[model samples]
Target: MPIVQCVPNFSEGRDLEKIEKIVQPLRCKEGVKLLNYEGDKNYNRLVVTVIGEPKKVKDAVLESIGVAAELIDMNNHKGQHPRFGATDVCPFIPIKDMTMDDAINLARELGKEVSERYGIPVFLYENAATKPERENLATVRKGEYEGLDEKFSDSNWAPDFGEAKKHSTAGAIAIGARRPLIAYNINLDTKNIEIASKIAKTIRHSSGGYRFIKAGAVEVSERNMTQVTMNLTDYTKTSMYRAFEAVKMEARRYGVNVMGSEIVGICPMEALIDVSAYYLGLENFDLSNVLETNLME
Candidate 1:
């Protein structure tokens, strides 16, 4: 059996009821397993992890996106995260016995379905991008939700599927295939967002920082603090510990304390093992040493 993982991000995270409703399709479904879900109130987003057969996973994702489109009103939505639709970005990762090409095909299938059924413009990104410019998700979502109308008006920014105009309330969505990405955040003790933003700029790749890091700052209002939120695009190239240490060192310059850190949604155990080995100064740590790794094998 082939396995594909779908991590769909929705724009509504503050309301538990709405979040549950959006994820209902993945629960009790045949050939699909709901691995995990994490919601952040400050960012007003939900990240769901599900894996199963390619067709099953694809079906569940499309159903969930439909629920999200109906329940979420992007026009009135506000959060620290950059989003353009109810179901902001959906990425399919090839897991067991699946290749990158397989994931891209799944993405295109879902994109076509969502566009035709719901009238939501879908932009295929990452490995499934139709053009080189759309390969980067950030570039596809450059203007965010508020700027979608203007973005679509320009011929250069037309979506791969559906009409050029944005959905009335659901807005637009970005669907694609990509390697595993870690959504990591380092919280700062201070409430100043500027300090967090400055540190983010120093460590993100777009600003000439780490090669595989995409970072920004967000205000966690409930916690009354700011965080350097990041997406470790390729953890193998730029591990979590490296980003953590960089943020820690930068925060010290502004007299800010490193409160703590969090990993949103599911991450590969190897990513954590790498961080553990670095922090523990392990000379020869390997997966063979992990009990669970052996058990699985």
Candidate 2:
């Protein structure tokens, strides 16, 4: 009866046939619901969201990771997103009747199985990280795929599971347990990636921005625009509207227009409610005011 959500990011996005094949295991599986899966051609990445009974969800994700390992070749991979493996990063979050400890155990279980079965090295990150330095995903992915060999050479950079070496075609993966975070992106109506990058640096934590924000810039080539992509690690502390408004304020300095914004995967309803209250200038607004919130109960 324990519920958990798993979001597995794969390195392939352009090829629809392969994308479907990779996610086939999660589709129509008992005790598991495939909430959403999005493929971004520009980033060349697929983000899949699924929530279900903990064990069933784990099995489905493991099967899909195997499919990704066989189908995706990291040597021929290229994208604006930083990645080091076929199944780049997989994080498990406790949903219902579950605790963080349960999620961490599930992450360790999957990490070990994937490493032994597919020969892919795994790094436990975030709450499941063995070392303080490995807790931040950015630090874990610093060198990326190209620098994997050099990274493996250092004793301090050894993986949590499997050999110290990276897989030839599949590379390596980061499996972790963490609190839910929103992956949001704001688009700017300009092909100038520098402007987007500047805005990203201004609002990201690493550059003295918001404490719970991790951000970067990427080009949305097909749309002829640039995007300020971000992960709002704690919405309660740093809210979505605050990040959106900050980006708008910075973009105005460069005379750039806000194209729009998007949430990459599923997000808490409270996050959207906060945004609505801010934009509508509502007084003392909360989830209780929403009709659907009451109906669900």
Candidate 3:
């Protein structure tokens, strides 16, 4: 299958009706399967993941972006995570036979078209970064929504597409192409958000922590726990064992224990296989024997 994956972040997570209103279009979109939709209350973010034929995926995204512009306005948005738009960032990733260059081209095409149609400024990031500085997502999201006005004023931060000015309703978006990533988090057993925050600072990339780790801690209301959520950018480069162990080690110092961990959306089977091998002392174990390999199409 010439499959490409797109994960688009939209600003409205507070209202289920509103989310359903926007996602209704995806059900009718040809060649796209909504792998998952995970909404984070603290971050006020809804991440919609889908995989499909190139054109079908693009059409679905275009529709989603249009609905988001009409329904969401970034100026009034507030969340724990950094963002700059209603439909903040959209990324396309290669799966199986698809190549990174193919994903990059798809991202470029989407960025250009969305910019032209919606007037939403676009920044090409990660593997799709026009320059090395933009390769790191943390660098691009530094200012967040509050800093967009100033960021646009600087010549150095010129958008890859669209006008330097921000869109009245949608704000700006960072569209990119990247490797398969895992949205993994380890929630520490503590109500004290401070400890979780401190541990988060010590583990994320921006604070001189793990290089492939982009992370932060947020409150999970129902659980009443502060979670250290992360995007393991290159899980192949940095294993989940290392991530879990690192957090386990850091949380121990703060007098906290690992409550539990979660894989927010669909993660590649190799991640679990890698964790099993590391934890079970099966250094040479091949994952072909695992049933998950056959289960995930």
Candidate 4:
């Protein structure tokens, strides 16, 4: 069976009951395996990682989206993460015996189905984007939920699937195919969001920072700390250690200490290995050195 990984980010992270309800469909699905899931109260977002046959994975994702739409109301939703829908962004990643094209096709199929069935506008992003501009998710979600209404008025901003108008409570969804990405966040000790924002701007791609990094500053109100949340688009180009160091180096200038770091959902083991090798100063350390790597073989 051809395997594909789907990470669907839903907008209700604070409510455990609703989050469980949203992910209930993925639990007993025959062909799908729920690898992991995490809810961040700070961002008010839920990140779920699952892998299975392409069609089965798509089916599971669609079911979860429906549940998310029914449970989460974006109209009253508030969080540190930028989102425009109940099921904010869903990305499909090809894993075993699958190609990028196969993932793209699955994304399109899921997008069409979700749009037709739920009446929510769907935008194809990343590799599945229809236009060059839409290729970047940040660009596709430029206006966020608040500006979604006016965004639909522009011809250039019309959705790739379903009506251009936004869903009353569920809002809109972005579905696409892309390579594996790491959702890493670095927390700072000080409660000043400005320091976090500055560090984010210095390390993110849009601000002429790293090549494959998209970053933003978020306030974790409950903890009274700030975070530099990031999406490492291609870890091969810009490793996790480099991003972490960049924030650490920048934080020093603001006299802020590094609180800790977090990985939102499942990440490739190689990414962690690379970080370990760098921090440990181990020469030529690779997956071959990992005991689990040999066991898998």
The top-ranked prediction according to lDDT is: 2
Clashing pairs in 3: none
Q: Write the per-residue lDDT of candidate 3 for residues 193-291, one digit (tens) a residue.
A: 888888888988889888888888888877878898899988888888888999999999878999789998789878888888887898557877788
What number of clashing residue pairs does each candidate have, in the order they appear? Answer: 0, 0, 0, 0
Ranking by TM-score: 2, 1, 4, 3
- List ranges where model 4 is wrong by over 4 Å: 294-297
lDDT of 2 by residue, 1-297 (tens): 789999999999899999999999999999999999999998899999999999999999999999999999999999989999999999999988999999999999999999999999999999999999999998898888888999999999999999999999999999999999999999999899999999999999999999999999999988999999999999989999999999999999999989799999899999999988889999987899999989976
Q: Write the per-residue lDDT of candidate 4 for residues 1-297, one digit (tens) a residue.
A: 799999999998889999999899999888999999889887789999999988998998999999999998898998878899999999999988899999999999999999999999999999999999999998888879998999999998888899999999999999999999999999999889988999999999899899999999988887898999999999988999999999999999989988789998888999999998899999977899899999965
TM-score of each: 0.97, 0.98, 0.94, 0.96
Cα error, candidate 1, residue 205 (Å):
0.4
Cα lDDT of model 1 by residue, 231-269, tens digit: 999999999999999999999899998988999889999
Q: What are the lDDT figures for the candidates, one per model? A: 0.95, 0.95, 0.87, 0.93
- What candidate 3 gets wrong by more than 4 Å, as runs, is 291-297
Sorted by lDDT (best first), the order is: 2, 1, 4, 3
Off by over 4 Å in 1: none
lDDT of 4 at 222: 79
